[model samples]
Target: MKSNKRIILHYDMDAFYASVEIRDRPNLRGKPVIVGTSVITTCNYEARKYGLHSAMSVAKARGLCPNGIYLKVDKEKYSRVSKQIKNLVLRLTNKVEFIALDEGFVEITDIIKSYLSYEVFAEKFKRGIFKNTGLTCSIGIGYNKLSAKLASDAKKPGGVTFIKDIGEFADFISDKGVKLIPGIGKKTQEILGLKNIVQVSDVLKISLQELRSILGYNRGEMIYEYCRGIDNRKVSSESKTHSISNERTYLSPLEDKEFIWSEFLNLLVKTHKRLKIQKFHTKTLTLKVRYLDRKIITKSKSMNITTQNIETLKKLMLELFEEIDLEKKIKLLGINLGNLSENKEYQLSFKNIENIKKERKIQELKEKINNFRKNIV
Candidate 1:
């Protein structure tokens, strides 16, 4: 019965941003190294000892560990390293879903069949990552994604944990708090606490109908199934891109409207270029602004028709930007072109015929410019 279960592996890099910094600068080893500016993105285990963690305010972290070596995030360098690690895992199996820059789920049901055991394959995978990237990751193996993720987080730095089947998973989490279950946040916990439902075992006592009544239909049903260590979510290796976006975080907050608008325009052009290259026409434009206080606000607008025209997109982006309150000094600005469609003829309108023709001509000219630029480079 245990052999019939699907084998899912979840791999998470230990203190990803901090680890990369330490790997590059060996002097940072054995020190409390922190990453990010406004908030803590990640920190080494040494920094965690001082009660510092991701999302904690930089001011709070400084108060906790005044002597910690704080550093800004280098996303481009980290992305390059992430791609290298991803390529290595792809060699083992193409069935990988990267959930974040430093963590992902890989279905190794078929791969382990060729090996002696799941443990053997996990160990080999971990060693391969370290050998190539000089970074350590924890691997968790289980019958489903939920268990695999939890198992990986149970051990830190360099650890491999395997939960063979549903029975083992149930027993393992039986005594743990309901918050241990993914998606059960503070509000949900508060709701459950009102009913004295605090632990996995406590949830097991409630009837399916009762749980449904408590948490609403969909969420309640999902929680009821999860309490029994039952998860039917499949691992998807989706290659199709759904959206294109670009953003910039400033070293100092900007209060000038002209300067901020100029920065946003640059991002919009870059994102539109990528959209055109991918042959995707977007109908929606979104503007994201993060203020000096770390509060984020976003506004979105959808055009009447899909388009690949940067001019039309620029107009829409400006409309969305105007909807946001720019009274506060901003630290970050971003643009996201979404509601993407690869099929160009999906939403053709006779009213926009003239505009469409103009867009096509502009696209052709842009392509020529891009080709010429590439040749010169």
Candidate 2:
């Protein structure tokens, strides 16, 4: 055992969207509540028992559980609740890394060393969240980020587990599926299965040379270390935005090119608004599409200069959209702004300045419309 081991804690909200709906609408409790129309974003535990999970078709989920309640996603409401949770975590530790709106990692080495036992601290933390927001989360405590995340998921819906040493980490994961380890998706799992590496322990028996031959040099080395419970990733709470985007799934597929272009423009507007609010600019823009048959595809383009201008984003996204085979009815459209930078004061070209002026005019017009409606009402 290492004397100077870091104590990392991963906090993940249980069925975040479904849980929030249940908390707000208590009658929905213990029911199979699904949270989307085109694709299942998530469902309550009751729905999970019926084989309903995130990304499954709502229609398929209905076939599985006909009496299940379906609801639209409330982004604004969820964002507000997520912000509350983030603020609460910040009160505990500044060393927090948010994986999503509902999941975060906190480095608690200093707090554990200074004050209470890990168990006591976890209990109090869970109690605190319920008291303030009426939400439950699972906590995982381990020497590294990967172990901590896996530990948190071990017992879910308000359970906590601690893996303090290599022995404990190894024993805990040995019997689990190879896919249980991070980065080993369905494809990688099949590739490993061919090599007779089905369980985490099987990975340990294979030589590094064998792993490299099967899974390439970089990925093979990473998994080899991970199987042995060695992860050196740090918990960081720095300002970083890898991407910002907006997406919408249609209840019915559309085939009209003009309507699809209009929808893309709407999504681009949303992406631009979010980028401005987050104070970010991007050098890459992506267009994501989902066909009626559930085939998902993405096209991305890189720019010479980073930008947050709507006109620039619209141009890039339109170009990506043009390259796609949109003959088939589209079920979803999304705009992804990536290669992000936090440089808010970057020099803009004359064209960008014109775009900014147009944006301001649009905002002014929206404000006037709202004010006029308020006066009339």
Candidate 3:
């Protein structure tokens, strides 16, 4: 059976924070604008031309471009503008998925009648965003989510690119770095680099068994398919939260085992309280540890039964920590509870019935004595 051709549109705002700053303060337009302190969260096209990009250090950015305009992030202002953009896109279709704050995927396959209609909608959407927020965006239309995302990336700042077929999608990403493929991050890059696999084409040429050995089972299998331009994910409008987490970063990296254990336990207790407040029960616990050199390792374990019990959660977290196996100083540590569901009433077990009966008898005796004292008075 043949599959229906999908019309997924990937929308990404152009240098979102920096662009918003430039829009409000028109004088900053042609200058190199940086939108963060301590770290470069984003930069304008002028800054990018000077080899400054997001996540670069402020000192390094200044060294690279001495005349760059640095502005603190106004999260409230940006959030309001983001809402305007999201509303504009939602008017076209309800099938949308958000990425971070500025990027989104809209599945317009059901609403659009033909390719001509898709083009028309794209132009109108771009015009609407600029008119309302004074910001420009890049849009990509493709047969699937991955292609759409790559297509948008290919054409930045007020450009639109389309990948209508699988052949076009494969050709577009063939020479690109493996990092460009979704979900292939720095750790995967490090592992694949050791095998001399640096490009998407390299991933395409590697055997399944070899890839599995390097990236473990699930992620390896998925990337093997992604290299060939295949992505089956839907553009869901509302994806439920699978987990909740809390983390702490140390001012200095921790080297002592005792300090690390204490910190881990503290974070776990905070996370558990949050889980209870949210009325959620989880079967899986995940521990995230970032090392001194910025490399992060995560380990998770699943329980035989779901629970919200503090003691049970603590026990599971300790077991998950054992899987880390690294003895290095840690820069950051986090606890995450996953495989979640709403909390339900606990059922009584035969072992606990005797305890409940004894508690009831004690309550009755106390009430009777109080009544006798009242009558004597």
Cα lDDT of model 2 by residue, 15-115, tens digit:
99999999999999989999986789989899999999999988899999999989999878889999999999899889999889899999988877665
lDDT of 1 at 328: 88
lDDT per residue for candidate 1 within 57-82, as digits (tens), equals 89999999999999998989999999
Off by over 4 Å in 2: 1-3, 291-300, 315-326, 347-377
Better by lDDT, candidate 3 or 2 = 2
Residue pairs with colliding backbones in model 2 are none
lDDT accuracy of residue 257 in candidate 1: 84
Off by over 4 Å in 1: 1-4, 247-255, 273-279, 289-297, 324-332, 344-377
TM-score of every candidate: 0.85, 0.85, 0.70
Candidates sorted on lDDT, descending = 1, 2, 3
lDDT of 3: 0.87
- After superposition, candidate 3 runs with Cα above 4 Å error: 1-3, 114-117, 243-377
Against the correct fold, how does model 3 do in TM-score?
A: 0.70
